[model samples]
Target: MSTFGEINEPSSRTAWEDWDDIFVTDDFLNLRLEKDVDIPKEIDTFIILEGRYLYDCVRAHHNLELVNSNAEVNLCLFKTKELNNYVCMIRDYNLILSSEIVELLKKYITISKDVIAIVTKPIVEYQVSELVSKDYVIRSISSSKQSTSNLDIHFPNLEQPNIISGVSAGVLCWREIIDKPAVAIICYMEHPEEQQIQELYELLERFKIIPDIAKFHRDNLFNSNLYI
Candidate 1:
């Protein structure tokens, strides 16, 4: 597995000096697909959830069928029954993907519209009063390299000093390089709070990407005595 920095060479050092690097070695990621998983030839939206909390929250609410899996990752699909809008979910535990895997993933999905990636950042990292008051704040950065009309309506653009790394960053960088459309939604929160999870659900629902389901299974998982 090759690192992103190695595979995609930057045109100039000064331009990418602030960008974070992805170091992918065999030791860090051992991806092995047990079975051949068929991905849809075309996709309306491809959603990637990085953190464990977000993955569990979405898995709890959506009846996602496992398409592929291994030790580090779980690939699932959520298709709307009526509209037939395909939403592919990649629950990446380690938040790293090789360039070959990234290309292979993009080759099949062939997202016609948008690629949405949701990742989390610690609230302590930022000093914004809005995050302190709201308990969580969702900001976005798009591949367009310019303000997106639709996304700007919902969440503000992610500012400087905050960089995206790992799988989400790799995908976004690839899309930007190819001039395709992709957006990374960064959620800044202290912990896995119900309010924050619900806000995420609402955001996905607004895009008509996820299904409506019963309560999240966070209570059972988070409050369980097994961890204590």
Candidate 2:
């Protein structure tokens, strides 16, 4: 079992390299499964939710089946009973660690025509007053043919010197290889808040992925022991 630290060891590839050497390991598979777990053969859309905050928000609202998991990540594969859409949620502590799971999933599932990925970045990284004033900023990345007009939020390009890693980057690279269309929604926030979570909930709702937001805030408040 090769650990992520060993797999990510210093490579000769430059910073700009994307998906050059993806290390795949079966060590992360859940031992409960007699054999490998495979994703659904045909998928309407493949959605990847990268952060723990986003994962918690969705899990709070919807019923997701635990397909397989390991110490680093949980693979929740479920279908929306109403929409009949096959969705796979890869929940990870760090987005970067998701790359390994993504590589593993690729073996079992065929890349869907539409891949929606949601990830978060820190506000300090951008330092834009516009972003600071709002709960969060959404930057859309898609193929030229795809329209983001429905989002109704805009921002300047990510600019140079910035690099995208993790499962989001891995998916984009795969999209290019498979000639499929993918949409990546990058949400920038200082921390997870009710408003930020609500915004993401609404976005996923629009995609017919998640159900209505439940009264999770109240539960969190009651469960918290923090004095501040």
Candidate number achieving the greatest lDDT relative to the actual structure: 1
Question: Candidate 1: misplaced stretches above 4 Å?
Answer: 1-32, 74-92, 95-101, 109-111, 127-131, 145-153, 193-195, 207-210, 213-228
* Top TM-score hit: 1
Model 2 CA lDDT for position 179: 66
Q: For candidate 2, lDDT tens digit of each residue in 104-165?
A: 66743344646677777775665443435765666656543443335443435554455567
Q: TM-scores, in order shown?
A: 0.67, 0.66
Per-residue alpha-carbon lDDT of model 1 for 108-150, expressed as tens digits?
Answer: 4355456778887787775553435766777888877543435
Off by over 4 Å in 2: 1-38, 93-98, 107-109, 127-132, 143-157, 213-219, 222-228
- Clashing pairs for model 2 are none
As a TM-score, model 2 comes out at 0.66
- Candidate 1, residue 211: how far the Cα is off, in Å: 3.5
